[model samples]
Each structure stands twice: as C-alpha cells, then as structure tokens.
Target: MKPSNTIKELLDILNSNRIGGVPVVDDKGQLVGMVSDGDVLRYLAPKPLGIAGLVYIIEEQ
Candidate 1:
C-alpha cells in the first residue's frame, strides 16, 4: 500500500480481506514498511499530556 492511502482505505482493505496487517511498498513495488491494526490503533489513540505547566484561571473583577 502507498503512504497516500487514507486510514479508511487501509481499514477497508484489512477488514474486507480479513488481514491483521499489510505491507507498504513504493512505486516500484519494493517493500517499504509494514503496518498492522495495532499500529493503526496506537497512532489513532490519543496522546498523553505529560508535564503540565502552570494553568491559571482568571475571574471577572
């Protein structure tokens, strides 16, 4: 699959074919990388908010 493929497209391919993962290739059909459902889920998962700084709330005087 090419990098341009959308998330929905990838999911569709994986689901319709009942595949857990698929290989990504370049224009030459050379292997570039592999992507799995877990990877997709992780990427789509919300990122953590680490090291919260000062957050102040102001009130109407």
Candidate 2:
C-alpha cells in the first residue's frame, strides 16, 4: 500500500470480517510485519508524558 494511506483505512479493514490482521508484507508478499487490533492498541496506548518529561529534566539537572 502507498504510504499516504491512513490508519482509518486500516482500522476499517480490521473491523470488517473480510480480513484478519493486516499482513505487513513487502512488494513480493513476503511477511515483513503484521498489525492487529491488539498490536494497534499497544502501540497507541497513552504514555505518561508529564512523568517522562520530569524524569528527563531531573536526570539532566
């Protein structure tokens, strides 16, 4: 797929019963990576930005 494709499209595909996790294949269909609902959720989990920033500042000081 083109890089311009949006995550919404991928989410639609996941929601549909037409396919399972999207096969992150190369141009030759060789599996390079894979994305599923769980994978997406894990990747999109809310991070603790405030705590992370505080830690970085403290370490630098």
Candidate 3:
C-alpha cells in the first residue's frame, strides 16, 4: 500500500483481504514499513489522561 493511504483505506484493505498487516511503500515502490492491525488499533484507541485529568479538574474549580 502507498504511505499516503488514510486509516480508513488501510482498514478497508485489511478487512477485505482478511489480512493482519500490509507493507507500506514509497513513491518509488520501495518497502518503507509495515502497518499491522494491532498498530492501527493502538493508534485509534483512547489514551489515558491519568493524573493530567485530575489536574485539569482541580484547576477548573
């Protein structure tokens, strides 16, 4: 897949092909890297705010 592909496009390719990951290529078609389903999931997953959330709450009061 091209490096410029969007997350949605990547997901579509993965799902349609029933694959876990795909190789990312540059404009010249050289292998740049690989993107796995786990990688995308981690990227899309909500990050924990932890202490930062508490600090924000305290400051707002």
Best model per lDDT: 3
Tens digits of per-residue lDDT for model 2, 1-61: 3234466777787777666577676677677777776554545544544666656643653
lDDT of each: 0.72, 0.61, 0.81
> What TM-score number comes out for model 2?
0.53
Sort by TM-score, top down from the best = 3, 1, 2
| Model 3 per-residue lDDT at 19 | 97
Give the poorly placed runs of model 1, Cα more than 4 Å off. Answer: 46-61
lDDT of 1 at 18: 100
Task: TM-score each candidate.
Answer: 0.71, 0.53, 0.72
lDDT of 1 by residue, 8-53 (tens): 7888999899999999999999999999886766565446423331
Candidate 3, residues 1-61, lDDT tens digits: the string is 9988998899899989999999999999999999998787556444655666656643653
How close to the true structure is residue 40 of candidate 2, measured as C-alpha lDDT? Answer: 49
The lowest-lDDT stretch of 10 consecutive residues in candidate 1 is: 52-61
- Winner by TM-score between candidate 3 and candidate 2: 3
